[model samples]
Target: MTTTATAAPGAHLPEHLDFLWRSPEPEKAYDVVIVGGGGHGLATAHYLARNHGITNVAVLEKGWLAGGNMARNTTLIRSNYLWDESAGIYEHALKLWEGLEEDLGYPILFSQRGVLNLAHTEQDVRDSVRRVEANKLNGIDAEWLGPDEVAKVCPIVNVSSDIRYPVQGATYQPRAGIAKHDYVAWGFARRADEAGIDLIQHCEVTGFHVGGRDGDSVTTVRTTRGDIACGTLALCAAGHSSTLLDQLGIAAPLQSHPLQALVSELLEPVHPTIVMSNAVHVYVSQAHKGELVMGAGVDSYVGYGQRGAFHVIERQMAAAVELFPVFARAHLLRSWAGVVDVTPDASPIVGRTPYDNVFLNCGWGTGGFKATPGLGWAFADTVAHGRPHPLIAPFGLDRFVTGALVDEHGAAAVAH
Candidate 1:
């Protein structure tokens, strides 16, 4: 197989030359203006148009659509979380994914093959147990698996009695699998376009014409190309949401982290499910095209840079070879990186902003790909009704200020 330096899963597109340099000439007022045309933004437009009859919307992308973290992900989808509220919401997302193809009239390649979080130590086993218990409370199918059971699920994994980062056990959920990331975005984009939503590409949001916190809430937004008078605004701009928030004088409780992902040439189908290992700091799975997708920890510092040094790549290789010995001979195909918008506690903030017409759907840290539908669905609900969804209310920006974060460090350490 081969690898390529493709654009990030989701990114902002520039506006057309006719729009203006950095601000459009207040063309038209949209019922809702979604910043960042990633999966979240596209899904939001689809739901608003498809479900709520709010078709007078505009999806503003600073770059090509879905050019950010949405396309950089390794496509691991699972709802096995450690917080009842979070687990509940993610489970809701899982349900939406189950019917995504029929809902969008397009294929998402949603597979229920399952995801395995390998436990390399006693604490890993304990954490798996805790996640299982927590997820069970929210009606998730998270099962604790011992070494033998792990082998039963994926015999290719060296879950034997002796090994580096020996397999003590694992956390397995049957309902998690992979999907084509770009396809998901295109599917939603097609539906949203069909519903009469203007996909204004190449539009950079430089600032907003904030008319105070009272009525006329955020009347217009000044973009790199032109100004758009949007009735409501939803920020789904991963890695760039904070900048957009700052433009509106909104201080978000989020940190930006750059994550790297690599893919190999198409090989024989050896991996069916996603496998995550914290002890090795690497999670890998084979894509439908048969390329082994590999990802590991992030850099020590946080920045918007999307390149890495040999040091990081070397460490990733060591972990991959240790886990799958055959990979030792595999040639290096391609490597790429993305700037992920992370929260202090590593959980996503997906609900409302202080401004009445502004909503937030970012801070996904390491797992935004799986929550694309959930974030869009909940965020759209917030924008449409001018109130936060019960599931997303707890994840408001106030959580960090109020010290009410749902700290799921266990999952964040590896899987996220």
Candidate 2:
């Protein structure tokens, strides 16, 4: 249960209880209403109220704060996609991360150890070189590193110089790194709550009370218990976006898929820089506490299900053990899975939907967690002005309608 401390009227300004311990009464209609109390939703609300003049806002979360994929991500931060638009925008996210702690006045524990994407075959090498050139041309710091260099960064990798699937090289982005996940969410939440945004937890959206036949407006959102009147709605529901949109007759071009991540027992910090390989279909990194965090491909099919067959985990372990001999002896500690909503082009679909006031911020594939802050900023701009930000123009939902997809599927496999 969520605990609440009573405050004098107008003490916790926006909607009284800061984080809204109870839905309380709708009190008054808000300027903006955000769905899914995850990081993106919370950060957008924070930016909207603090950065813009839109203070009257209500954030509706189906469950507790940031308990969805925002909490389940592997925490690998990077902007080294194969395309410039993808890299440039995500790089902007990297810059934002550099100042997150100060902006939130909270320690985020960001680590800039860099990311190492490995190439195991000739094709892998070609793709790696092509990507490195693409990234460098885009002003992102990316370079090709051979096996000898890969050893310098990831010495623990059990790679043979001349063996089959030999490590041809790697793409290193010194600008990419990892940050504390929950801290990001909490940092955004604390600031938004302090700034007078109503954060409603456990307020599942039962349906929508949309106005205007064009579906370009929202009158109010019917909740499990109450109806919230708001000028606009932003959906940051991720894996649940399509389902939520379906409730309002808005068809989202996204489908949900399950992705699993596992962590090993605490060991001496054996892994340093993040390591990813498409050939192996595995990627891993070690946390400050020494737990080895790892992930593989997502389930092929679509479902809200978070559980997958044990064989998927088994497949991932084989590759991990082969790459790093040390992992062969480490005891497995825990494994968990999350559902992800993917768009056709493997990029996030940001900005306006058919519904005038309802905006979408989903489809990061495996890269949403770290993109939270920047997405928050851009998304808030769109909602406040009812216009798309130039930086995120390529990812508009209408891109699909116009055949202007910026496909980054090749680099996105290990992107986040």
Candidate 1 segments exceeding 4 Å error? 1-26, 212-216, 410-415
lDDT for each residue of candidate 2 in 242-333, tens digit (9 for 90 to 100): 77777878776887888899989999976778998888888889987889999987888887765656898998898898888778989889
- Candidate 1 lDDT over residue span 19-109, tens digit each: 2112223256887898888898998898887668898888887777777777777888888888766786778888899999899888888
The alpha-carbon deviation from the true structure for residue 201 of candidate 1, after best TM-score superposition, in angstroms, is 0.7
* lDDT (C-alpha) at residue 47 in model 2: 87
Worst 10 residues of 2 by lDDT: 1-10
TM-score of 1: 0.92
| Cα lDDT for residue 269, candidate 1 | 85
How big is the positional error of residue 111 in model 1, measured in Å on the Cα after superposition?
1.8
Q: How many residue-pair clashes does candidate 1 contain?
A: 29
- Cα lDDT over the full model 1: 0.79
